[model samples]
Target: MESPDPSSSAPVLLNIGGKKYATTAETLTQREPGSMLAAMFSGRHTLPRHPTTGAVFVDRDGKHFRHILNWLRDGDIPVLSESEYQQLLREAEYYQLLGLADYITEKLSWKKGDGTLETELTRKDVIKCIQAQKTRFRGVNLSGLDLSKLDLSEVDFSYACIEKTNFSSANLHKAKFKLVEAACSSFEHANLHECELTGANLKEAVLDRANVQSANLQDACLTGCSFIETDLRSAHLQSANLMGADLNGANLEGANLKGAKLTGTNLQGANLQRAYLREVDLRETDLTGAKLGGANLLGTIR
Candidate 1:
C-alpha cells in the first residue's frame, strides 16, 4: 500500500450523511490527533469510496461537520443559535472533541465574551441577552423558564421571580434565591451546594437527587416538596415549612431542622444522623428505614 504524501496540496472529497464536502487532510486532523476524523483518515477502517467520485464516505452529520472543519481551520468558534450550539455540542462530543464541547458549554453559560458574568440584568434584558448571546442569566427574573441541564453556578436571583423554573441537572452551586418565589420548580439532580434559599417559596418543588449540602432554606416554604435521594447534609432548614414533603432516601446528616414543620412528611430510608429536629411537628410522618442515630429528636410532636 502506497502512503499518501502529506505535502501534496490535493483536495479530498468527503461524503458524510449524504452530503458532499471538499477539504484537505491537513484540515481534518488539525489540533485533533485523537479525533474521529483522525481515526477515519488513519486508514485503519475500511472506508468505502464513492462509486465514481472517489470521495470517502463517513456516517456523520455533514451540516455540523462544516462547523467542526471551520474550527479546525481557524480555531475560532462562530456565534451560533441555541439550537445550533446544542447540535454542535452533541457532534463535538461524538467526535471526542472534549475541549470543543467544554468551550461550547462555557459559551452557553452566563459569562460574556469579556469574561464577565451577567449579574445585573432585568427580566426583559435577560430574555434579550439569552436569545442574542445564547447564554444563561443571573440576577434577573427568570420565572417559568426551562433551564434544565445547564451550568448556572454562582448566580444570584435574590428577590427575583423564578417560579416553575426547570433546573434539573443544573450546576447552581452557591446560587442565591433569597426571598424568591420558586414554587413548583424542578431542581432534580441539581448541584445546590451552599446555595441560599432563605425565605424563598419552594412549595411542591422537585428536588430529588439534588445536592443541597450546607444550603440555607431557613424560614422557606417547602411544603409537599420532593427531596428523594437528595444530599441535605449540614443544611439549615430552621423554621421551614415542610408539611407533607417527601424526603425518602434523603441524606440529612447534621442538618438543622429546628422548629421545622414536618407534619405528614415522609422520611423513609432517610439519614437523620446528628440532625437537629427540636420542636418539629412529625404527626403522621413516616420514619421507616430512616437512620436516626445521634439525632436530636427532642420536643418533636407527633
Candidate 2:
C-alpha cells in the first residue's frame, strides 16, 4: 500500500476480504507498523512488472516502483505502445471514460510516419469496442445495437460482434473496426474516413450517405448493403461482397473494388474514377449515372 506520488495523487481507499479499509497508499506490507494488510486483507505481494518475474510486494519477481514514473502523464492509465494503448483504450472504454478514450483516440490518430503513437502502434482499434461496458453504452451488445441517427465518430470497436446493428448518421472518422463480426449492420449517413474494417462481416449492411475515405473493407462481407450518396475515396473494398447492394449517388474514386460481387447491385450516380475493379462481377448490376473515369473495368462484363 505504498502511497502514490504526491504530485500525481488519487483518492486512496483500501479493501480487504469483503471489507473496506481507511488505509493510506503507504506500506501495504505486513511488516509496516501501521500497515493495513493484516486487518481486513490477508495477501501481501507487490504489483508485477516483468512477465518473467512475479509480484513485487513480498520479494516475488515483479515490476519496480520506478516504472510508476512511466505512467506520469497518463490521464488514468499510461500506455507505451499501440498495443498498450489499445489495451488501455478497451479498459477506458469499458470503464466509461468518455473523455479519456477520446483523448487516447486523438493521440492515436497521429500519422505513424514519425515517432507518434500511431506509427508505433499496430491496428487494434475496432475490436476493442466490442466489449465496452462503459459510456452509457452498456448492455448494448453487438448482436442487437440500434444506433440509428447517432454520432459515433472516432470510436473504437476492434473485436466486437456488430451483427445486425444500426449505425445511421454516425461519425466514424479514423475509427478502428477490424476483424469484427458486423454482419447485416446499417451505417447510413456515417463518416468513416481512414477507418479500419478489415475482415469484418458487413453482410446486408447499409452505408448510405457515408464517407469512407481511406477506409479498409478488405475481405469484408457487405452483401446486400446500400451505399447511396456515400463517398469511398481511396477506400479498399478488395474481396468484398456487394451482391444486391445499392450505390446510388456514391463516390468510389480511387477505391479498390477488386474481386467484389456486384450481382444485381446498384451504382447509379456514383463515381468510380481511378478505381480498381479487377475481377468484379457486374451481372445485372446497375451502372446508370455512374462516372467511370480512369477506372479499371478490365475483364468485366455487365
Candidate 3:
C-alpha cells in the first residue's frame, strides 16, 4: 500500500498552556493553509513535546483555544459580550485567522449603544415600522435610504446616521433630528417647520425650496450645501458652518445667523430682513441683489 500521509496521520495530543487537547493533524492544517497551527504541524519543523506524555507543547493561553478549534472544524461561534469578543479577537489575530477577525469586527459593529446600527434593517423594515406607528428611530442607521414623500412628522431621529438619504417632500414638522449625520442628504421641498436639528452634520446636503422655517440648526455643518429658495425664516443658525453653501433666493427673514461662517456662500437675491448677523463674517459671500433691510450687522466682518 501507499505510505501513510503526514497530514492524515493519527490524533496528535497537544499541551496548550497546561491544558490537554487531542485532534488530528489534518484538522489543524486543512482549514487555514497559512495559519500558525498549519506551519507547526506540517511535519517540516520539529516541535517541542512533553517527554513524559509525548504531547506537543504550545505556549499560549488555552482559555479560548477550544473555540478556535471549533471554528476551524465547522465555522460555528456562540454569542459573546463585547469584552469577550475583544478577547477572542486577540486570540484569533494571534492565530492568523483573518476571517474570524473580520467576523468579530462585524459583530462588534452590530453591538447596541455604540452610535451604529444595533441591528441592520432594510427599507422594508423601516416602512413596516412606520406603518406600525413606531416612529422613534433614535441611533438607527438610515444611510443611503430613500425615505422621501413620507409623512414622518413629529418623528424622532436623534443621533442617527442619515447620510445620503432622501427626505425630499416629506412632512417632518416638529420632528427631532439632533446630532444626526446627514451628509449629502436631500430634503428638497420637505416640510421641516420647527424641527430640532442642533449639532447636526448636513454637509453638501440639498434643501432647495424646503419649508425649514423656525428650525434649529445651531452648530450644524452646512458646508457646500444647497439651500436655494429654501424657507429658513426665523430659524436658528448660530455658529453654523455655511462655507461655500448656496442659499440663493432663500428666505432668511428674522433668522438668527450669529457667528455663522459665510465664506464663499451664495446669498444672491436672498431675504435677510431683520435677521441677526452678529459676529458673522460675510467677506467672501455673494450678496448681490440680496435683501438685508433692518438686519443686524453688529461685529460683522464685511
Which one wins on TM-score? 3
Across residues 223-252, which tens digit of lDDT does each residue of candidate 2 receive? 777788888998999877788888888888
Query: How close to the true structure is residue 136 of candidate 2, measured as C-alpha lDDT?
Result: 23
Q: Candidate 3: list runs displaced more than 4 Å.
A: 1-119, 132-134
Cα lDDT, all candidates: 0.80, 0.60, 0.85
Q: For model 1, how does the per-residue alpha-carbon lDDT over 282-302 read when each residue is reduced to its tens digit?
A: 778899999989999889886
lDDT of 3 by residue, 1-302 (tens): 12123468587888878889988788887778788887777777777777787788787888888888887775546667788889999988998887677656655654554544533577777777776564877757788888899888888887677889999999999989976778999999999999999878899999999999999999888999999999999999999999999999999999999999999999999999999999998889999999989999999998
Clashing pairs in 3: none
Give the Å shift of residue 83 in candidate 1: 42
Shift of residue 202 alpha carbon in model 2, Å: 1.2
**Model 2 regions lying over 4 Å from their true place:** 1-140, 148-152
